[model samples]
Each structure stands twice: as structure tokens, then as C-alpha cells.
Target: MPTDLVLLNSRLLDPGTGGLLPQTALAAADGRIAALGDDRGIGALAGPGTTVVDLKGAVVVPGFTDGHLHPVSGAERTMGVDLSACKDLASVRAALDAARRSLRPGAWLRGWGLDPNAFGEQPVGFAAVGAVLDGVPAAIDLFDAHSMLASPRALELAGIDGPRRFAQASEIVCDADGRPTGLLLEDAACALVEAVAPVPTEGELLDRTAEVLRTMAAAGLTGGHAMDGMRLGFYAELEERGELALRFRIAPWCQPGADADAVAELVRLQGTGGALWQVAGVKLFMDGTIDNGTAWLERPDCHGESTHAFWPDPQRYTEVVGELHRAGVATATHAIGDAAVRHALDAVEKARTEGGREVRHRIEHIETVPDDTVARFARLGVTASMQPTHCCEFTRADHTDNWSRRLGEERASRAFRCRDLWEAGARVVIGSDWPIAPFPPLTVMAGARHRRPSDLSLPPHGPEQALTPLQALQAYTVNPAWTACEERQAGRLAVGFRADLTVLADNPLNVRDTELRDVPVRLTAVAGRVTHRAPDVS
Candidate 1:
């Protein structure tokens, strides 16, 4: 059978073995690999209508998959002022001042990627940037996305005054005087301000989201396990319009108070998808984040916080997990603290032991787990979906960062145990929880190998926790496919597998950790359709 697309003059690399096959070309038809062999042999299989290209000896491997991310939410959050590059209070103020200047009359200023570290000695609050935000009604999200700093005016617009109670582990932070400080912790608290914040029109959001997905494709991500399914309609619209660039496996949220009906709805949502997108699982937060003092730490932090789980009733969470497991629904729970990780693991263990099913369940952000928790992942068959960049960009090696300071020395030392989990025989997958971290797959792979910041100037946070280059590659390629039960159909360059592949300027395994993040992506194809081709690539 004639192939629909052919690529010649390429090096076929196997992510699993760090090997290069003798074949220099491959062909794809009907969105899957049709043939692979020498350039002449595969080239001859191209049909008259086939699109053919010469790679000039570029390296090709199975396309990278972000083991976890929130694509639609990331796009929406980042559409406003970008404070990610701001390093200090002065820089943050300067950026907000600039955005304030450009604001239309009475327009609320919205921004995201505000780093809490920028506050230094001061606490994260509206007052930190209030000088520039007066009368602006601004709501800026901290980098974690679990928290937000709302200006007083924004608070008033949202009708918030003093502290409020939440069913989950969220808080509208109050000062010693019991007055709102503008620092909202966790989703429920942040939603108070977000409810009043301006939102883009549906068309506008759809267009911006499409652009972001293409940008992710350009970064060599052919697919992502989208941790949020709030925008399933948006994905469906894009898929119907042929604008969806990445394959998305969406998991909608199953909140703390989810009833039997909610659990059943999530099960029914299974297999709901379009050509390149689907509703496959459910997302639940076991806890919030350490930076905000909302994570369920086994012990209290320096501020006597983070001692509680997101769910008010902890056993209810276990029950929900078991219910989902019995119904054959896989779950990805957000568990950053040690207690949260242990509980999530326990829930999965219970679900597995009782239900005895082959569901592929996973836990996200195993941030500060102990040695015992690490071993349980493999034993319980739970995949560890970690965002390495969260360690690389957020925390510090000397324990000076807020995340480290809050946990103190011991708990902080166990940060992001990627290598520990992998060595313990657990299936570890890497990702960029985009908007929380950058979504570039190579940067994520590099962070897994180099725990230090991208500049490589700082000392490695947990040098022992660094993954080998090949292991990092497999985390993004092979492991993600296995977690999704698509290993047989994707995650490799074999014939008959999905033609989801990435063409890189250099072999990722051979590139230095510092250079890997910047490695040029020559081409990215999802299901045989080229979504991103460098202008330089012929």
C-alpha cells in the first residue's frame, strides 16, 4: 500500500534503547507508520499524492507527551500580563505598572505567573503591588495557580471582606486583625476573585487556546494528559474545526463533595472524545501546595500550616477513589505533600486490592514523599506524574526558597523524588504543569536530568534524584504511552504505530542538559499530520 507521507535522510532513534536503526527513512499512511527502511526503500512507497520531505539527517523519535498539564487553563491564565520573567518586587511592580497604564478605562487588570519569591521578606499580598494597582481591580495569580493575590478593589468587586470558611483546605488569608490580606490560598479561595475577573469571549479564548496548543507542538509535544477537563467543549470545538494541534487526554475534576451521581457521570464521561482529544479520567486534589501552606503535610510547617488535606473528610476521598476504581475510571490526584502522597497511594492500594482491576491510576506532583511512599507507587501500580520544572524553576538548592524554608531542611531535602521513585521500580512520568511551569517538553526532560535551574549556576537541589538522560527521554516518550495504555500503538517509531513523532535538531540523549532545553525542534507530527514545521525545514 502506498504511504501518504514520507521522510528521507533522517536518523531513526529509539528512545527505549538510545539506539539508532540503520533505516534512514520512514513512511506514514492513514495516520500511522506504514513502512520504515533505507531512504530509497521507504521513499518508493509514497503515493502520488503523498507529501515527502528530506530531513537533511535530522534525528527522529517518537513524539514527546507531557505526562501532565492543563492546556486550556494555561492559555486562559497566561493571556494577560506575564510576570513570569519578573524576578523581584521592583520588576513585578514595573510590569504591573506597565499593564496598568495600558488598561482601558474601568478595565480590570488581570495577570498571572506572579512568583511569591519576588516578595522576599514581605508576604504575598495585594499591598506588595498595590502602589501600581490602585483603583485597577487587579487579580494576579501566583505561579502555583493554587493561590492568587487580589487587589482590594478586586476583592470589593467580588464582595469579599473578612475571612471565609471553605469545605476544602482553601483560605482567604487574614492578617492578625482578621482582615482580608488579598492573598487567597487554594482553588476555592482564588475562585472568589476569579468569579468577578474579566474573561475573554468564547471565540477569543478558543483562538488563543489554539495558538497555545500549536506553540506546544512547536516545542515537540505531540500530546498531553490534560489534567483539567473544564474546557472539553473548547477542545471539541477545536477538534471539529481541525484546529486541535495536540492529542489531549482530559480528566475533569471530582471535587471534595462529589456524590454518587458525580462519580457515575465521570464514568460515563469515559471514552468521550474527538479525533485528537478525549475524556479519559478524573482529577482530584489531595492537597493544595506547600508555598501557600495548604498542602497536607504530615507535620506543620514553620508557620504551623499545611497539616490538613484538601478534603474536609479524608476517608470520603478514599471512598471516592474506590468508587471510581470499581467503575473502571482512572484518577490523577494532585498530591504535593508527604501526607497527601501517602494517602493517595493508600487510596490507590485500597482501590486495587479490593476492585482487582487493570485501571492505570496515577498521582501527580509527588513533591515531598518519603522513602516508604516512593516504594508504594510501584507496588500499587500507580504512575508518578511529576513536573520536574516545578523543582527547577521554583525551589532553591540552599533551602532559601519559600518552598524549602516552609518545609525546613528534612522535608525539603526530599523534594521531587523523581529518581527515587524510578529507582524503586515505579513508573515515573515527567511533564510541565503549564501555567504553573513551562510546557516545553525538552525543558521538562532537561529538568528531570538537571535538578538545578536552567542556567546550571546553582547547585543541584537533589543531585541523587536526577534521572539519566535516556531515562528522562523515556519518561516523556515511552512511560507516558504505557500509562495511557497506548504503548502498542504509540510512543515509538515502529511501523503500524501512530505516526506521532518529533524531528529534533540533535539527539536529545546526546545533548548536554543545558543545551537540551534549547534544542531546536525541526518538525512535530501528530498522527501523520505535521502540526509544526520549522520555517527552515524543507
Candidate 2:
């Protein structure tokens, strides 16, 4: 007989039934919802020693679940240099100078989220960044995280000596003289830099994980799917320490070579049944990103480029995806372009034919899905896991000539159509892709509803494919839960469901569009225990 707590006088929004009930009371006991109904009905179920919280005029809804986010990368970035605010070369140099002076000598100086285009210039070379750092080793990531600007000292440390050739499916944008430009495009350069960089200790990783969980809880998020590159035994360690607070569905990046062996190891490590800290899933990258002009396309956009750099061998991708499916491990692959999407769909179809159905795999991004592939997702029972903010972020670019010319007007309309996918019968799940965009569910909801940032006007980009506020909310809540296969125990507010809910300062349905980003999360509860609460402003 665990003590019960009754949340009274709150407006409840249930996405499961598309219903809004006012002055509702929700009772929680033994880490599960005991009763939920009108105030009188719920009050009658409350025991004598139960606690009662009057929410007054606030709104209550199921806790948000970010379907995709890089929690580990995000945590590390929080302690590293944040170039997200640097607007120009001068600002970048100034920040580098400041970081170099503050950091230990020869320690890797890393920064993320610098857009060369935003700095009002074409991509610059390493010398540009080197001149600013006065020869300090540094690596500044572009906004897409697909590319980076590395100083000469940093490249030297990575043992990248003279005229480095970009690996297959990777590009090393170079000067006419064949000298390595500061920019490292695609996974080749990224892998080199990562191999040389310092790996955080187990303790440090756990500390960072805790910090990220607190931040997510503050943002009204109680759970997320961590899609960070595989760091062996990372989740196991966190779970052992009991430091992982938020519900995490970790999908480790698949390693090259021995696909079956690697997946077997992952499965054995996962043990029987899933837990809050770890679940069974392997992440694969089928192609490059659109921001860097690497997304794979069937017909070379007007740019004459058919696909972003492929991983040298398409067989490796097929092997990895196929083996995981055969082993009964769920797979989530990143496919942003039409060609990559088709390729991924083909792999899933093959897996189903050979390995039998029941492999509930998913396609990440689907930013530029083609019309023909929409129905294929539903027929194959593949989940379309997408991020809403990318649509607004990319569409708002003023200079769209390059992208528009490459993607043609007709084909561009198919970009990130959440509503269209839903109509096509795809199980559409929304995610923030966090370190790439804000993780606040309210912000994501607004972006989907408006199809543009608050300050930007709706580009005729895909307005007809935009989702309503309620529909967008469902994508963030129930759809993600369904994709994760946790719908019965999570996502909704019915009896026997997890007591995970967020209390907002105002009803989201009544809040202004602009106010969505600023919506204050008054309280957050996980497993029937309040984890976060905003101080009373009055």
C-alpha cells in the first residue's frame, strides 16, 4: 500500500484519444497511474494518508520522449567550446584565442556548431582557423556535425601528413595546389579526429550523463533514444552505477567487419528483456547529410552529383543491416536522400524475405523521402523516425538557390513531410535530433505546426504537408513510444502506464505560437516521483 498522490484541478491532454478533459484529477500509487477522471471520481479513490497537489490552472500531459538524440555527444559538448553563438570569422578567432589561453597546453580544443555560411563566407581552410589560434591544436565542427575545420596542429597530432586523400564516400575539399583544406568532410575526417581525441573516463561519462538527464528533465523530457556512436560498455557502466535517471533507449553505431559477431556481442550484453538504461538496437549510417551536399539521390540533382560519398562498399551496409535483422536485433539506419532511402527500404525488404518478418526496424531522418517510398514504409512496417526542426531550420535559409537548383522545385516539396507520411500510413515518429536542434517538445511541436521558426515566414517549402499542433504532439509522445515498443507501459496516461507526466505553466493548446519555445515546465514526474519543479515566481 504505497502512499498515493492525487493531482487535482489540472487540464489533461490525452493524445491517445484526442481528448481534452478539464479539472481532471490523476491518482498515482505504486509507480503507476491508479485512477484518472473528473475531480470527484479521483478524489473518492484517494486514501486517507494520500497527498494532494492542486495544479490550479496549469496543464498536465504525458512526459515527452525525444525519439532521437546524442546524449553522450551533447554532454561532452556542454563541457567543450560552444561555437553555436559565433557569427563571423573574427568571433571564431576570438573564441579560439580565449579557449587556448584557458585550456592546458596540447590538450585538444574542440568546438561545435559553426556555420561557414552563417559567417558570410564560402568554406574557409585550416590556415584561417590556424591563424586565429596562433598554432593551437583545435577542431571546430560545422553545424551539421558531418564536417569540421581543423587547425594544422590538430591535423599533425592526428598524424595526417601531407596531401591526405579523402576516403571513398568522403571528401577532403582541397585548394587548387592539392593542399589539404582546413575542412574535413564526411566520416573519414571525422573518424580520424575522433581516433586521436581524448576519450572521457567512465566516471566523467557518467557525470556528463547525469548533467544531460537533469537538463532534459528541466525541458519536460523524461526519456530519449541515445544515438551516439558506440562506446563499448558505456550504458552498462551507467546502469551499474544507477546514475542514469532518464529512460534511455541506446542505439550504438554498428562497427565495420564481423557484422554478425558484433551484433551477437551487443545482444548478449543486452541480457534478457530491456531496461531503462539500455535496449537492443544498432544504428547504421546509409548516406551523408543534406547540409554538406552528401545525401544520396537517384537522379543527380542539377548538381550532377548522384549520391553523397558511399562507404566505399555498399555490401558492408547490407551485411550489417541484414545480420542485425536476422539476429532479432532492431536496426535504425540514417537515410536522408532518396537513393539512400530506397537502398534502406531494399535492405529491409531483403531482411524480411530471408530473415522473416518481426524485425521492427526504422529509417532515421527521411528528410528528403520520395513519393513512391512513402507507401513502401507502411507496407514494410518500417517506422519513419524524423526530426521536425530540420524542416524549419533548412527551409528558412535565405540563399536557397544552391539547394533549390540542386533539388528542383517539385522534388523539394517532398522534404520532411510529417503529415504526408502519416497520411501515407507510415508510423511517423518525431524526434529532436538534439545536439542538431533544440530538444524541447514544445519547440518541436511549434516547428511542425508552423513549418518555420518563430521569426521566419513560412516558405512555400511544404506548408501543405505541415502537421497540426495536436498531431505533432502525438508524434512526439505516442508515436515515439510505439516505435520504441514501449507503448503499453509508457507514452499514455491510462491505468498501469508509467506515472510519467509533465505539468506546464499554461495549456499548450491555448498558448501562443511564439510562446511555445518559452513555455515554462512547472513540474516533471517520473515513476510517480517528482524529479523537477520550477520555483514559484510569485
Model 1, range 1-538, lDDT digits (tens) per residue? Answer: 7577799999999988999988999999999998889988887887788889899999999999998888888889998899998889999999999999998998988889988999998988877765787787988889999998898889999999898888888899989998898999988888988888879998999999999998999999899999998878998899888889999899999999999898898999999988888899899999999999989999999999999999999899999999999999989999999999999988988988999797889999988987888888888889999988889888998999999999999999999999989999999999999988888888888888989877777888898999999999999999999999889998899988999999998888899987898989999998889999999888
C-alpha lDDT score of every prediction, in listed order: 0.90, 0.75
- lDDT by residue (1-538, candidate 2, tens digit) is 4446788888888877667764388989886888788888887777787766778767888888888888877776656687766656778778878888888877878888775545444555665654666567777787677787777777777776555555456666667777677678777766786788876786787788777777788888877877874553555666566655567777877644444667677666543333456655878887776666777887777656646526557677786777778878888888888889988899898888898758789999987777798879999989999887877765543336344546777667677878888888988888788787777878888777777764555553577777776777788788878887788988787888888888888877667665677889987877776767777721
Clash pairs detected, candidate 1 = none
Worst 10 residues of 1 by lDDT: 126-135
TM-score on alpha carbons, each prediction? 0.99, 0.90
Scored by lDDT, model 2 comes in at 0.75
Off by over 4 Å in 1: none
lDDT over C-alpha atoms for residue 399 of model 1:
93
Superposition TM-score, candidate 1 onto the true structure: 0.99
